[model samples]
Target: MAPILQVDVDALRQLAIDMAHAADTIHEFDLTQPATGAAESLESSSVAAISQNVSWSLREAYRHLAALVDQMATGTESAARIFEAAERSFTGALRRIH
Candidate 1:
């Protein structure tokens, strides 16, 4: 006989919700300051460019995580349904063994 599987759908959903909320809390700092030093030296320009790139990547990562979390939360209902179906089938098989 297959092992019975137990799951806490509500808890999973809540975790996903929490993750999304946490992701939302991530705020990007202002990095729009112009690089002005030694008459716009190469080092200053490179630093500014790299900082901008890093900022953009960070924001994108946060948005991605939030989106994934939201999706997981939304899919919890479907996951619960599948689990319910499996449990029902298992119960039926057990009953036939008597």
Candidate 2:
């Protein structure tokens, strides 16, 4: 006996949409300006350098995370499409046999 595969394609598609939106939000976020401003107020070159490095690191991290999320969104949408196609194919095959 084969195991039944049940999928909610609509929900999966919505989740993909949501994930895409979240990735966009994360990618658009700016962290450098505030960090620079704070560092400038401290008036120490070492502090400014450290702050810039931290800011750059954080921004890079967020960009990487956003890219990953975008990839996941693409994968999820692809999965939903595959599932929908499979369901349609199965239904058509069943109808032809009837």
On a 0 to 100 scale, what is the lDDT of residue 51 in model 1? 60
**Backbone clashes under 3 angstroms, per model:** 0, 0
| Per-residue C-alpha lDDT of model 1 across residues 15-92, encoded as one tens digit per residue | 756755654564333323432332245464667566667656766776676677666655765676677688879889
lDDT of each: 0.61, 0.90
Q: Candidate 2, residues 1-98: lDDT per residue as tens digits?
A: 12124888999999999999999999999997899897898766688778888999999999999999999999999999999898888877777999
Question: Which residue pairs clash in candidate 2?
Answer: none
RMSD to the hidden true structure, all candidates: 5.9, 3.1
Q: TM-score of predicted model 1? A: 0.48
* Residue runs of model 2 more than 4 Å from their true location after superposition: 1-4
